[model samples]
Every structure is written in structure tokens, then in C-alpha cells.
Target: MKILTIVPAHNEESTLDSCINGIRNQTIETDILVVCDNCTDNTEQLAKSLEVNTLKTINNVHKKSGALNQALDKYLLDYDLILVQDADTIIDNRLLENAVKEINKDTKLGAVCSKAGIKDIMSSK
Candidate 1:
């Protein structure tokens, strides 16, 4: 199954490198789409340097949901599964593989929520 990961970024240069590296190191090959939404920073350049698929927008929607929706509308039909990932989140190499396995086994499973570390949660909040 083909999986597509959509990463919505806005002035996330500091974290984008790690995130892109993590995605590149995943055990399962995936088509990554990094949408640089109304960013004035070097986010697009960073993504391009990593050689990952990228898109840039100037709409200034300013919401992750809007960016995600734009990506979905553009590329949803091409992929079997769509992963909406945060720009700063670092994922395990086996993350997508494990999730796909579980999802395939149970068609009734509607959603899966990941548990974040306490420090991460606290910092984000």
C-alpha cells in the first residue's frame, strides 16, 4: 500500500531538519509532502535540501487544518493512506509500518492516537 505523509510547516526551520530526517529513515518507503504555508523563513529551502517532495503556498491561511485540507484535496486520491504529521514531530522508523499493520488487521478501528512524552506534552501546552 502506498502511504503519503503530509507535513504542514510554517517557520519551522529549527525542527524541520530532524523531522525530514526521521521520515527519510523510515523502514517503509513513503511519499512525503511538506507544505510550507505562508512561511518567510528557510523552511522551503530546508525541505528542498533534503530532496523531499515539497509545496509552498502564500495564502496566509495560518491554520494547520487549512494546510492539511489543501494537501488532501491535491493528493488524497493517489495514496492508500494519508498521514497528517506535525512539522516538529519526530516519528519512529517503524511508526507507519506498525500503524498500517494494525489498521489492515482491524477494519473496524476508526482512529489511533499516539501517546506523547510528558515533557513534550507539557512543553507544547
Candidate 2:
């Protein structure tokens, strides 16, 4: 199945790289697209440097939803599944692999979502 992961981001320069890397390292390979939502930071450049696809929102006023809508409008028909991932999140490597398994196991499955967790950045410091 063709899977595309859409990441909606603004000025997320601090967290975007990790999120992109986490998506790239997933057990199930997926195409990543970073929606640069009227960002005034290095988000677009960073995504480009990471070698992932990017879509810059033009005068988006609806924030996250609008960014997603733009990307969805362009990609909704191209892939079998589209994962809307948060820009600040670093997902587990097995997330896509496991999600795909569950989706395939049940034909009625509408969507698969993961539990969120807070990383101990203070402890690392």
C-alpha cells in the first residue's frame, strides 16, 4: 500500500528534524511531506535539507487544519493512506509497521492512532 505521511509545521525549527528523522526511520517506509505553514523560521529549509517533500502554505489563516487541507487536497487521491503527524513529535520506529498490520487485519478499520508521550528533555540535559 502506498502511504504518505504529512507533517504540518510552523516555526518548529527545534523539533522538526527529530520528527522527520523518526518518520524516515520507521520500519515501514512512507513518503514524508512537510507542510510549511506560513513559517518565518528555518522549517522549510530544514525539511529540504532532510531531503523530504515540502509544501508551503500561501496565506493560510486556518492554522494547522488549513495546512493539512492544502496538502490533503493535493495528495488525498494519490496514496492509499495518509498519516497526519505532528511536527513536534518523534514517533516510534515501529508505529507505521504496526499500524499497517492492524489496518490490514481488519477491513473495517477506519483509522489508527498512537498514544502520545512526553520525552524527558530535562533529564537529558
Candidate 3:
């Protein structure tokens, strides 16, 4: 199954590389789409440097969700499934494999999500 992962980023220079690496290291083959939303930093450049499919968002008041929906509405409808990921989060390499396995086993599965143990969630809040 072809999985297309969309990463919504907004000035995520510090954590973007880690996130990208996490995706790249996934066990299953995946097409990654990184949406840079109103990024004033080097987020676009970083994604471009990696030579991954990248898109920039326009009219992004809703932030990450808006950027994500832009890709969802426009390009990337050929994949079997879509993974919504945050720019700063580093997901496990086994995430795609595990999620796909579970989803495939249960045909009625609408969505599969894993827990993100963000170390600074409290500090950010």
C-alpha cells in the first residue's frame, strides 16, 4: 500500500530535520509531503535540500490544519492512505509499519494514531 505522509510546518527549523529523519527512516516505503506554512525561517530550504515533495501554504489562518488541508484538497490523492504529522514531532520508525498492519487487519479502521510523548508539552503550554 502506498502511504502519503503530510507534514505541516511553520518555522520549525530546530526540529524539522529530526522530524524528516524520522520519516525517512520509516521501515515501510512512504511518500512524504512537507507543507511549509508561512515559514519565515529556513524550513522550506531544509525540506528542499532533502529533495522531498514540498508545498507552501497560502491563506493559512488555521495554521497547521490549514496547511494540511491545502495538500489534501489539491495534490496527493493517489496514495492508499494519508498520514498527518506535525513538523516538530519525531515519530518512531516503526510507526508506519505498525499502523498499516493494524489498519489492514481491520478493514473498517478509519484512522490510526500513536501517542507522542512530547518532552516539553508542559513548557510549551
Please tell me which predicted candidate would have the highest lDDT against the true structure.
2
Give per-residue CA lDDT, model 2, range 62-117, as digits (tens): 99999999999999999998889999998989999888888889999989888888
RMSD of each: 3.6, 1.2, 3.5
Give per-residue CA lDDT, model 3, range 1-125, as digits (tens): 88898999999888888888999999998888999999999999999998889999988899877898899998666888988888888788899999898888887888888976757633674
Candidate 1 residue 57 Cα shift, in angstroms, is 2.4
State the lDDT of candidate 1 residue by residue for 1-125, as single tens digits: 89898999999898898788878888888999999998889999999998889987657465887788788878989988877788898887888878788778888885555555423533773
- Per-candidate clashes, comma-separated: 0, 0, 0
In model 3, which runs have C-alpha deviations exceeding 4 angstroms? 119-125
Evaluated against the true structure, the overall lDDT of model 2 is 0.92
> What lDDT does each candidate get?
0.83, 0.92, 0.87
Model 2 CA deviation exceeding 4 Å by range: none
Give the candidate order by descending lDDT: 2, 3, 1
Model 1 weakest lDDT span, ten residues long: 113-122
